[model samples]
Target: MLDRLAHSRGLPQVIRTDYGKEFCGRAMVVWAHVRGVQLRLIQPGKPSQNVYVESFNSRLRDEYLNEHWFPTLLNARTEIERWRREYNEDRPKKAIGGMTRAAYA
Candidate 1:
């Protein structure tokens, strides 16, 4: 997902994320190093540094997850894929001057 975001906007010089396994795994570090994309890790138990994504999670949940229910994993995946598209393309965001995510991109 970070790669997708970076590619869409152009290669970012750096990225900040938590110390969770997904972000701290060897593979992820290797990939970031190879790409010259600095990975800034927030200290464990300190969340204020990652407030951007933490805040976005609330919005994502409210606008997408809260609006739908799924009977199966496949169904959920499909709906999420479609919802993500619309959210990225049409949903307005305050972070980007109140423009849709794609528009801001």
Candidate 2:
């Protein structure tokens, strides 16, 4: 997911994340090092530090996950990708003066 974002939108200077195994693995550490990106890990048990992502995730679960039933992994991926595109391209965001996320970007 990070790789896809970097490819599509360019690399971010800094990545802030919690200490999830996926983010803390050796492969991710090496990848970040190779890309010259800074990875800032929030202190354990500090959900406030990653509030933005947490909030987005809550919204995703409420609006998408709880509402859909996927029969297979591939179908789930397809549906989630479609939801992602719609969220990024059409959903209006309050932070950006009610513009769609794509327009804000």
Candidate 3:
């Protein structure tokens, strides 16, 4: 996923993530090291430090995951991707003056 993001939008100098096992693991460490990307792990118990991701996760669970059941992993992925595109590209956000993120960008 990071690779795809880098390919599409270019690499970020720093990645801010929570102290999840997936982000803290050796592979993630090595991947960051190889790319010269700094990994900024938020302090434990401080979800406020990563409010955007936390909010997104909450919306994903409530609006999509909780409402749908998928018989296959591919179906789940497809639906989630659809939701993500709509959220990021189509949905208007009041924070951005009621413009979609894609339009704002």
Candidate 4:
């Protein structure tokens, strides 16, 4: 998934994540090292350290995930991607002066 995103949008300088096994494992470490991307791990049990991601996750759960049931993994991916696009590109955010995230960017 990260590979696909990197191919489409280019690599980020750093990735901030929790100390999950998926992110902390050797393969992920190697991948980031090869790409010159820094992996910044938040403190254990400290979701507040990653406020932006936590907020996004909360909104995703409340506004999208909780409202839909997927019959398949692909369906879930597709629907989530659709919602993600709308959330980032179409939905206006008052915090950003009532502009969509893409437009604000």
TM-score of each: 0.63, 0.78, 0.90, 0.87
Please identify model 3 stretches exceeding 4 Å from their true place: none
lDDT of 3 by residue, 1-104 (tens): 88898999988999999999999999999999999999999999999999999999999999999999999999999999999999989999999999999899
lDDT of 4 at 30: 98
In angstroms, how far off is 27's CA in candidate 4?
A: 1.3
**Taking the tens digit of each residue's C-alpha lDDT, what string does model 2 give over 29-94?**
999999999999999999899998988788889999999999999999999989888877998988
lDDT, residue 39, candidate 3:
99
Clashing pairs in 3: none
* lDDT of the candidates, in the order given: 0.85, 0.92, 0.95, 0.95
Q: Please, what are the lDDT tens digits per residue for candidate 4 over residues 29-77? A: 9999999999999999899999989988999999999999999999999
Question: How many residue pairs in model 4 have overlapping backbones?
Answer: 0
Error of 1 at 65 (Å): 2.1
Question: Each model's RMSD to truth, in Å?
Answer: 3.7, 2.2, 1.4, 1.5
Query: Which ranges of candidate 2 are over 4 A from the true structure?
Result: 97-99, 102-105
TM-score of 3: 0.90
